[model samples]
Target: MDKAKHFERSQDTAHDQACDPGRRALLTRAAAMSAASAMLGAGGWTALPAWAADTAKPAAAGEAAVRQGVWRDQKRLRDVPWRLRLPAGEKPVALVVFSHGLGGSLDGGTEWAQAWADAGIATLHLQHAGSDRAIWSGGLAAVKAAASAEQLIDRGHDVQFAVEQLLQLQKSGDAAWARVRPDALGMSGHSFGAQTTLAVAGRDFQMRSAPDLSESRFKAFAAFSPSAGHFPGGIKGITRPMLCLTGSLDGNPLGQERDGRYRRAVYDTLPAGAKALLWLEGADHMTFGGGGERGAGFGQRLLGRERDGAPEKLAAHHAAVIKTITTDWWRWRLLEDEGAIARLKAPKGLNADDEWLQG
Candidate 1:
């Protein structure tokens, strides 16, 4: 079958599942059973396995439950929502905080967070006030009001605030976060959010310091389709490992410089050993979730249509490769999962033909 036909079939299947109550219930029950089995298998319901567990369990509690919560960063005051997903237990695992690109929200990073969460890692997805994609669709006035340079600065501060808030939550007896070790933190962002992560890591990009770094914390960083225009200066000071993921055709006139040159400049300048860059061929800025035909603007605009290749299929392939590689990178760097690094640095041919590691 043609790629379009396959996509349509997948969408139809998903729609049917959503509309069919019986299937939904059955799926939910199956998921619950799987979770229970994983917990109880051989180990007798021990709170996660030792490799995955963060802290020692108390006899009274039996095993700690992975906790999920949502809270606002008062320091941001932009009313953006941030969601936290932590493993169920008292053992604090390394934390991975995600920021969204321009016009993206907490929901934008939710799938990525969920992917990591399912892998036994914790994630925090932050929704930037005024700067998410909603502003773009809301009209030019809204976009101008939210996507300003000042707003970007505020957004960067929001990232710092999120880190501080997570640390505070850990200290304040938040059951869902009791096992979170604030010291073991990694930051990631997509597009402008990727720039924000750089700013929080003290990379000398276009962003200004919030003077709250003493309280804010992170150990490593990853960025996807980072906006080069906001390249904060002084990135050389960042000693932590960094990863940059971009597509050959990601340049969008609106935010990221249309020419891949800017991203190339930034990625090339970063110090070598601790940094890696992945380039996906035939992918544009919108390749992640929203650009495909099945996305919000399917009929209105050809978000993922490519002349040389099947855009939708290529985009899906890129997103999957990114999710897999990134999760492995985080596992290796943050959780000290030695086995994950090899998988991350493995040749792209193993997953997708279009994937390439660039210098």
Candidate 2:
């Protein structure tokens, strides 16, 4: 599918009138990103403040839930094409911004974004120009040239730019972007996108020439199939709530961990407690992208093949796993739903093949 057009169609859909100023203010304050000092507390359930603990509470059994809506527009963010998925009602909710992996389009993590939107959270899909699927424009040659210290920094700023743009919309009271709950924002990425997530979540690099990419706006992070950068400096323990998703076999031949421990490596560096890790059994690089022939052969050739014996058959089940984990997790972080945090602590609802481990 023409990735650019895919984003265009996303904005073409009908949008429901969103939250009023009063409701938007309430949701934003309730979900605002916590201070770094607050995050430093022991990194476990016990560290959560009374209000944070209160946010973790679940809804009554018989209560009706909110539905979600989607809006797409290629020009919404200028050069950065995007798709916004929001909750259906006029009440405000949490919002998450997702970055696509290398050689991936905005829809790469569609299933997860859909899951968030379905549960009354908003999701903004970001398509970074330099490192996105467009890198494969001329096949392998372009693909080989895709990764660099430069583009990675650009990817990180793209997210900041998106957030800044929304802040502007909030000021203008624009019908679409303005409705986002001001303080209830989270960030996530897949593969190369995971590297971007690391950059935004306070991970600095060796190059001084690059822009200061650590963004305070994104209060939490979720990285899928994250890769190590070539430059020198690295990540220390991140303080915010984080969920690292990786598979036993999810390694890139071009990455530092040839044995597929890259995901765990990133997970290891995050502060514990508000942090969790999901290591799906038999998952691979392509599984997170919904499984199929991907890349322009550059990725396939350089990395050979990063897949299991029955990757196609396992794709659907893995999709469900991502959906369940992300939906419940955002509920914990954004809504302050105590029950969602409990669900994440145990994660018994996922497939038996999955392992839910925490810091």
Candidate 3:
């Protein structure tokens, strides 16, 4: 099937869901609250079981522990949902907080999270309600509206609030939170979430909506499919290390920037410090967004698969390269592993067409 045709049919299916009264009633209220909460300030904490997961296992050599929960801020009436993935063992490890793109949920970065966990790093995937998969229950208009500037600002606050909650949880002796090294932290995102990552990194994108939404806690950053054209000021306020991942075919779905090369502006404009760019030959936008063993989620379904007809081996190859490079990044930057730095400089796994640069 043609990619455009498949995406149109998927959008039609999504629009059809808007007609379901029950689904409409539930998600509408939640999305509305998410928008409202973005404007309000912070508040108290309320905990709720967000999802069902496998048994919480101790950190073994090859396994990771998964836990899910919703952390609510009463003052803003914002319900921030999250999923935590920890490496095997009880030792403290570096933590990376992941933000999903528009129409994505906490389940968005499953592949990346699992890889990071298996590599002995902890990950927390955050879902911004107003812009998450909930908006899909509405329609194309709703999805577009959910990506407003207001939600972008709200997402930064959500990251800050979530980190605050994590700190409190650590102080209170939560097992998973306790294993995270607060001093060693990183931030990452995909697409719109990439914009959020930049926001948290102190790139206000020349917007004054929220005086300064930058949080100084994150030590390093990574952005997948980051739009360098969207924001004018390039790497002005971001002094921390950043890794940018984009593919030759990673075009913008919203038509803001048609060519994938435009995405390279993110790496191009950097001021030359601890920054790196990984340009894959055939990977598409959805390729960087999850889709592990469990398969594609809303991102892949909405944007079409990166490996629609290409060789299946190529998809596996891309996945392997991504996981290896990203895990090495977290280790080198967050864990201060010297050997990881060497691997990052040369980057062992890459096809002839793939390019990896470091400065």
Candidate 4:
């Protein structure tokens, strides 16, 4: 199949699952399970037997300070909805702007954002106008149509514009905005949002006459389930530190490249400086989206359970490992913490079969 057509079909499937009420309910249950499994007390979160219990501390004041708003780019006539999650304090912290997948909204990536905030990092979740949940409202045709190259470029613009706006807000002395470390900004996303992250991180989409969409402000990147087919221009200009997170079962559902290992191209094609790849053994695409083992429901429903039931413990372990490694990445790249860098060199909370490679 043509890569573009395959990408479109893949996105269509993503939209279908993301919009499914059953999937949504399952995701919610999975999230609740993740939270419940991690929170043992005020001391710290529950870690896998391989990791210490104090590996992840609770959020400051028991929760993050969330601020929500809509910012309009008058030049492009674009309205970007954003949600900022800050650690519960006035100190300046590293900020990572998160982009959601197709048909996703600012509500996406909350699990990662919350974990980062708890670890004293901030997240700015951006919702692009042309490719958000609004597409699902128009039905499957609109959903499929929303997965366009133009929309992909627009998402990059959304990230740039949102970051620019954040800089301006910081200059304006907004207390919450002031807490963001402008010099330590990072970019991250899941699925199509992962494509957006790479675009801003310097990957090109081979768009004709397209101005450079890569934003130099992002110091590092963390892409979850990034699409290799969406950006055929490959890793020409991307040179910053990046961490690719994917799963062994993280396959393209509606495309020819059904094997999840294909997603590793994003990590494999990079120039190899300050780059890392975390390949979870049993995690699927939605696992990075916060569904854990339940995220593999599509395959489970199709091929029957792996053992007559989901391994709830493994699900929690995946969530814990993601939070642990990603939080450490932010600390290392954004905060320049030597301890974090050391931890990333040999991260804990992984099963024996998981792969953590860096170069």
Candidate 5:
């Protein structure tokens, strides 16, 4: 099937969902509150279950553990607009690029980037021109309709272009992204950004049976809220250590596929070793990406009404868990942190809020 045809059908399916009044009617006030209750635990501060593999007392402590003992600064590349998350003190051991989901910006990736910086690693939060939040200045409708096959292809080009510029800057002794270990590079993204990461990691769409756009420079990968069943031929050449994160509520609300399980296909299809998946019980799609209003509001759009999310305090806890997991994965994959390996491997120390699977 031609990718253009696939994209047209996808848009039609999504637009159909938007036009269905029956679906909108089902998302009443009662349903909104129920959905909120299902997502948010007691007092709206949804408490996390005791992690069997992680004995960390509170989510804040774990957040602190990942955020502590590291000095960092955020800088902007002159023309690129890429957010540079450079750890203070010594040179970084590795570099990681974080691409935000469709209609997302650099801020969406700040939490994870900070966690990586805290671990003494560098992170680049790439901002895309055509697909970022600028497209949503009107409202959610634009966001849903903003993505196109051309924009999708451009997203991948953006990643490759940013990597080249960064490497060239380092070579010129800019000292910002200097000392980044070429062997330990990492790539991560959320939602549409995950699609971008997949392209850079060697998932060949074979659009018209075209060539793949895998960037060998990326040695490790991570994704949040990635839609499955889109990439044909699966991940043909991706073999790097990978971490796929999602919540029980994560899925396509506008499309027919609403189950979170569908999102796991990437993890299921990746080559065996060094691959891991973290499923946060009761977590909605927005939780993994930590979208302030966008994350919370997308749920409302999904349900066809305006519904608030878990309490602010409770939501923050979930975001913290996401940060901890990403930082730990990067640690093990890029810097060879033994503690991260122990944490990732600890079968007995599981958090009640998080269900982990490894392959």
Candidate 6:
């Protein structure tokens, strides 16, 4: 099936759940909180205050709910924006730090973080100044002009810095942060951010020198629509379980091919027993974000482009599905939720789908 048709069918299958008024409300609320938290004050825009331990609540209807707010990354250059969501409870099973693609921000994939939050996991969406697409395009001309390897190195530091700050917050008994199991920490990102995740997870992307892994953290990693330009020499020496997700409709055909080649290279090189690749059919790079016609249209407008039709709708549907799968994957890997894993690994088996499993 063509991309448009495939997305339409996926939309039809997901329509009921995705359009639920409650779910939509939840997403809106999360978005609003994220925005509000960002604008509250210097601290609000920069970093999250200690979470109140007593503020935890249980998920309504057994669904994980997101807590929208900002977190301060002291290491962030110029205090970038951040969004965090956590399951309503005192005990968080695990923490996942989510990084956005080049030219994207915390808002790019807030819903994905919400899904993880709803699944009883805590998620942090960090917006890095040097690597964010907006910053790259509008503010940091020099960094934007840097070689792809340098860009990856810069982004990798952003991820590493964010993780370090979070760890510090956890160690400092911040009330806003529910103590997370350090060993269960996971990292995920899209495009450039994806490559950063790999670099931070003890993998050398050949973009720059390998980061010091002994001080490196994160038990698992997920990369969505990752760019492979930085992987000139391929990923090597990654022992952590990794998950790489992609879409059939990702633009920049060259980037997509490179992403796939490096992903396979890393997967093939990794020792057996702890890695997976999921390629969603009829989906594009934007699918991992807000995959609705409206959201896609808005994204295009932000990029100063004219609006299109089927592509927008298809993109939105892809976003919803990606959100679902992301939650499932993190739940399985970090929370040890076997049921979610089974669902994620199982095929929907409908037309226009692609998924591969390797060791």
Q: Model 2, range 21-94, lDDT digits (tens) per residue?
A: 22233233223323322554434122111111111112244322322222221222226666666665656778
Against the true structure, what is every candidate's RMSD? 16.5, 14.8, 8.0, 13.3, 14.9, 13.1
Runs off by more than 4 Å, candidate 6? 1-80, 136-147, 205-215, 230-233, 253-272, 290-317, 349-352
**Which candidate gets the maximum TM-score versus the true structure?**
3
Tens digits of per-residue lDDT for model 4, 107-149: 7788889899889999988888877877656755565566655
lDDT of 3 by residue, 190-309 (tens): 877787887788763432222355889899998877765433353555778889988876765544333458777778877688788998887777677776311123434555534344
Segments of candidate 5 deviating more than 4 angstroms: 1-80, 138-141, 208-211, 230-232, 256-258, 291-314, 347-349
Residue 120 CA displacement from its true place in model 5, Å? 1.0
Model 5 alpha-carbon miss at residue 68, Å = 23
Q: Per TM-score, what order, best first?
A: 3, 4, 5, 2, 1, 6
Q: What is the TM-score of each candidate against the true structure?
A: 0.68, 0.72, 0.80, 0.78, 0.73, 0.67
Between candidates 4 and 6, the lDDT winner: 4
Is 2 or 4 the stronger prediction by TM-score? 4
lDDT of 6 by residue, 1-359 (tens): 33222211111100001112222333343455456546654452244455322233445865554444344443232354555566666775688887776566666566666667766778777766654544434433332332233344445655665666677667887655545777778988765566567667665422222234222567788876554332223354666778877655554321223123433344555557787776656555556543211222233345554433434666555555666776777778787888877886664542355666647
Give the lDDT of residue 72 in candidate 1.
43
Candidate 5 TM-score, C-alpha based? 0.73
True lDDT of residue 290, candidate 4: 49
Cα lDDT listed for each candidate: 0.55, 0.60, 0.70, 0.70, 0.60, 0.54
* Candidates 1 and 5, the one with greater lDDT: 5
Q: What is the Cα-based TM-score of model 6?
A: 0.67
| Local accuracy of candidate 1 as per-residue lDDT tens digits, 141-224 | 454344333444556666665665666657777566667877778888766666666667665422122222221467678877
Query: Which window of 10 residues has the lowest lDDT sum in candidate 3?
Result: 10-19
Residue 20 Cα positional deviation in candidate 6, in Å, after optimal superposition: 46
The CA lDDT at 173 in model 1 is 78
